[model samples]
Target: MAGLVAALIVGVGLWWSSPVSSGDVHRYVTEAARQQQIALNDGSLVELNVSSDLSVKPTAGERRVTLAAGEAHFAVAHAMARPFIVTAAGVSVLAVGTAFSVRLGETGVEVLVTEGRVEVARDPVDAATSGGGRPKLGVGERTLFYATNP
Candidate 1:
């Protein structure tokens, strides 16, 4: 039984090492005058407004995205195996099979979760003033943290 198990493990490792298929997490749309929507392999959809930049990376470990600039709406699909993470400005939002939208600018940041739940973490903009890094965001809520000194 031990020898058989070892052989099986080796076979699985070999199979995993072989070439595998790939899929795009989200499509990149830049400098658009209108709205842009992207459908992902995980059934999630992202809608972007004008003058925006968003990058989606769907991998086995984690489904990551970045809203570099502008506004975007995310309709994340249900996936227990992987979690969805979005980072914009100095803030990071994490979702577990939920839908939400995020808008970031020089003023601050905004996050709205339409379904499921999400976690928001504050970015360390200025340690001297704010004391430390970003704040922790809870589930089923929205918050706007100012970049001002306390």
Candidate 2:
């Protein structure tokens, strides 16, 4: 039917206009004593510090990054509808149009905000072992999260 065809066309158009239409995974890593900078498809920028590992996956609704090790700085793009979330060592840092850095250490994770604000929360799985409450960090603010069991 013509109605069905029109609806299908609209759906395809919407999908094409999305920030990230496909589930593509991007990985970035740095060697010892070296640093790397990455520019994401969504216009965000990431700086990986020495011996760091990072992965980025932007879905239709959110831009997510995982810090497997070391430290990285994020200069997030302004996407109000899609929040930028960085996860490291059971901690999640959520930001919108902000800049910050996250570091994973042997003891725990550290977050430093240089611009705007970010909300830091512990993953549910690590709640029992995570100490301290959820904190919102603004410019020039920083926090360190330590595992209660560690």
Candidate 3:
């Protein structure tokens, strides 16, 4: 009985030492001809361009943002244990302590890496499943993603 109790305590301690989970409690939106600067709970900064909409959802071991429209420049805080990911137009961009910009247009999605590195992947399909890793974009690199008509 004492051994079982010890094991339970260790298990709980390990989980507690891990990253704690958080939810999307903050949201920001910009109107036409207007720009806004938002500060997240985790000390990250987001410069929202005109006519942009985004939401921040922090989960266990990861921080997520859903960009519904327009463009934004993000200066993420350094958190190696928790990756920051942005989803726009069915595309995902993962970063850790990076500065980048993402623009969603009617034609396609555009990403610009200003600092650090980021991994980009097309959504709805797991890149890892095909044994192909997601493409990594380094600083000063830019890419455009356009979906093909099936």
Q: lDDT of each structure?
A: 0.69, 0.81, 0.80
- Candidate 1 error regions (>4 Å): 1-27, 123-140, 147-150
Cα error of candidate 1 at position 105, Å: 1.5
Residue pairs clashing, model 3: none
- What lDDT is obtained when candidate 1 is compared to the true structure? 0.69
RMSD of each: 14.9, 12.8, 14.6
Instruction: Give me the displacement of residue 71 in model 1, in angstroms.
Output: 0.8
By lDDT, the better pick of 1 and 2 is 2
lDDT of 1 by residue, 1-150 (tens): 999999997877544333233366444654544566767778888888776767777777777888888888888887766777788876777776778888876777789777766767764222122223344444466776455534
How do all models score by TM-score?
0.67, 0.76, 0.76
- Pairs with backbone N, CA or C atoms under 3 Å apart (clashes), candidate 2: none
Tens digits of per-residue lDDT, candidate 3, 65-146, equal 8888899999999987778889898888888799999999988889999999888888632223322477889999999999
Worst 10 residues of 2 by lDDT: 124-133
Q: Model 2, 1-150: lDDT tens per residue?
A: 999999997887544322342348777666675677778888998888987878888878788888989999999999987888899988899887999999999889999999999889877312232235557899999999985463
Q: Stretches of candidate 3 above 4 Å error?
A: 1-23, 124-132, 148-150
